[model samples]
Target: MSYRIRPAEQGDNEAILTLLQGTPQQGAVTLNFERQPDYFRGARVACEQPDVWVAEARDAPGKVGAVYNVGWRHVWVNGEVRPIRYAHDLRIAPECRNGMILHRLFRHLRKQLAEGEWMQTTVLQDNQASLATVASGRAGLPTYYPAGTIETSMLYTRQRMPRLPADIAIRQSGSADLPDIAALLKAQGQHKQFFPYWDVNRVHGDEYCYGLNASSFLLLRIGGELKGVLGFWDQKPIKQTRVLGYTRGMGMMRHLYNTHSVLRGGMRLPAPGGVLSYLSLHSVIVSNDDPELLRLLLDYAVAFFHGRYDALICGFFQQDRLAKVAERYRRRLLLSEHFLVSYDGDPRGTLDMNRPWYVEVARL
Candidate 1:
């Protein structure tokens, strides 16, 4: 009945995935073990190689009881770039939670971190058990501090909703367009606090392209000049759950506001164990400071995927350059949120909503 916690290695992928393929809904999330084609390529090649921890048992040897990824990032926070490590995909077998295994696994993880290195993680605000764990952080252990909430605006463009600006054209992007796409993302990255500092050279290489269900890009042009760019990602098959009661912790009014947004659209809101056939609308960047450019892109995306997907997901940290435009599509947007937390609190109070923050789609 003994278990050992150790760093996960290459051969452990299947075991790790088995743990992720939930026995049933463990909490609000149901992570997909079925990853998309080459989806992890960019994440695997991150500057700080991803590290994972697995719980191996002695009795039923080769059995994985739990797993998590201590993924790394280069982020801009408070006008300074710092290394940030994210604790992602934390999964523990339902049978294992009551034991002291959770504590021991985390304690082992603590030993791996170097001095002054902060590890960041996120949790659903309503996932009380995980939040309580973060709140009770042991002495000398890295405790995740809830900095602020990042809302993921999921829009279900089931039928066509017109808003496409006149005279703008959308075209498919190719390998020859990498430089243009990279440059656009970089320009937009500067506006968000937690946006990753992409190693563009590597990002432009072969690895990053084949990392999604579709490595597709769209260029929006006005009179032969590029005004905006958008990426189409089929985040489907690699799914996530919209566990219903996860919203129980929100204030009545906020919940009502979100519910109203959903009900008004008449689209079936995702349920706890459902495979969110989500299409990610990512790599959103624009020039000319025009909110209308975002409009054009959204319009084109709706037209492009009219019957191909159920919903489109897009998000930005509050006060991001796109936030203003996002508001313009208020009627079409529904609510979901992710947290941007740090192990070390922002002593400078800089990672506020007023300041920009970014969570790259690839990392999430």
Candidate 2:
């Protein structure tokens, strides 16, 4: 049956939710709504937004089959703010898995993205169907490899912190440390196609950076020279009873980012006097190119978080040698084979998934 593609409406939320729930092969069925209502709400909000799109079979009215949640962002690349599009979520119901359905939907999506000047969507590594769909098209090409799946790794420890064979020490970052952080970030910017919204400067200036009653950043220093850094935030899970309070009037899109930001921040937002564990392994780097130094820095970061929090989660790219280094620390693989696509300048030069670098989607 022929399908009609149109923008989703508020009334279609139930159908969309049903489709999402019905597609079990996509996994994440046990996703905690209490902890992350924003994900579901954001899907509805995307449909309501003019930029979002939905596909429904013309012969089956009211049966929403697929969804493509897209958004725009300005990336600082090559010293300029470049407009890019993020394809956040794309789902197709099981009943609509016919190849023709996907073909038509993708064709429509490509046309929309091309006209809108969107660069690309960062596909999750495990979503093989989506990856194949994008790669099947002539217009589609592998762009960027963001990170490996979210996995449980060895708890952070002080001893694990990387210290150069010389005199490096792991210490709390200070306001004065922003310049060195900026310099490290600038070095990363040179090779990356798309720039993340939260950079070193923003992190240093944001509320999360100031650490109001909570630690947010850690720096590895050698003889007063900054060599590596990490960031974290305090976060806690919302009880089922508190779901209403958490969901109360939160805008869909904003809530989406909020939930993800909280999760990615790696620390749970603290509940009232409840001494919930507080910490997140935001980012890590070691200036020493030696693999041994990198391993030391990673071990130390994990040890730091493990000591501070009940759980330590990190996002490392598949190509990053750190992924292998992290494995030595009892890291349990959570999400593996995630894909990131970027639309930088020229598509050819902008997308390079084979490069060895971890893309940080949300900073903890």
Candidate 3:
């Protein structure tokens, strides 16, 4: 069967959602394609920008068989403002599993991003198909999760804050705090894709930030400057037995991103019920001299969450420095086996655990 790959149109929302739902592999991650109308709308709007592409079965007219959500961002790596195309969501319908779908998407995206640029994406360690997809491509060598422990930490109301020196203070962020938060994140060497340029605008524009149920965010300030930011959200603990239902028939069980796979093999840990939280110890930018400030900021963030939420879960990509600190707090390692797939470029480099990059936190 032939498929016509093109940009998604506004009219293709329902068809795209149906295609996503039909893919059993995506079902485990709680990616309720039914409720993501806005995300689809956003993607469609983004598709209008000439860089995004969608694949649809030609015979079925509007039925979107797959979506290749790609976009570019400016990165100031090593003092150069290089443009990097970041591949977000790459989904293919099970019926149309031809390898050529992704290959075509890559060729199209590469052509769109051809003017003096680079591309990059991260995949989980266990996703062999996606890992193979990217590794076998023309891109550079893919980076596997180097040996590093991913620590999970929970903050319940019962824990007490550790005594700290007098310079650091926790402040609630208002709309006025967005730009400063943006700057601090950029300064901490966080890639622009992690914290999209319009993230704050989207949050505050529709006052949708208030609608977030499981997540809460705050700014960490030291000496009255925005040193860093912390945010957390509650996630449904993936039930191991439930996940096995999907993986049982396969030769090699395919884990769903991070959340679902973490719960597999009875290794699942309990998550908080009321106001469960996932903490992002986002960028700690201190004066060139105050290196220890990062440690202090993290400690306080954990203590703050413990005082508020019932449990806290933080994601650590391989090679993240914060994972070392997470070890000291005795954070449980939840989902380290899963990988993310990016079609842009090689997946080497430090995974920034600080920013809200995980799929569960953002789209889930």
TM-score of each: 0.76, 0.58, 0.62
What is the Cα-based lDDT of residue 1 in candidate 3? 56
Q: Write the per-residue lDDT of candidate 3 for residues 1-364, one digit (tens) a residue.
A: 5677677776776776666556433333322222244445444222223244678777777777788665654444433344445555667888768556765766666556544344444444445687676546454333333223333343222245667658867656776777776676556544422332324444542322323222245666668877666654332232011121222333123423224423321122222111123433322344331436555655666556553443344545444444455455534454434333333443435444333232122321
Show the lowest summed lDDT stretch of 10 residues, model 1. 30-39
1-364: candidate 1 lDDT, tens digit per residue? 5789887776666676666565434433333433323323433633255677789997776788997777776776665667777777778888888887877877787677665456655565546677777678565445555555655666655355555457777878777766776776677666656766655445343443333422377898788776687877664434444333334434234446446545443234344444555577666777844677887787777657655665677876555566666565433443324443333454335454555556565446
Give lDDT for model 2. Answer: 0.50
Stretches > 4 Å off in candidate 3? 24-35, 41-51, 80-82, 137-159, 175-203, 206-217, 231-292, 306-320, 330-364
Best by lDDT: 1
Winner of 2 and 3 under lDDT: 2
Instruction: Score candidate 2 by TM-score against the native.
Output: 0.58
RMSD versus native structure for model 1: 5.9
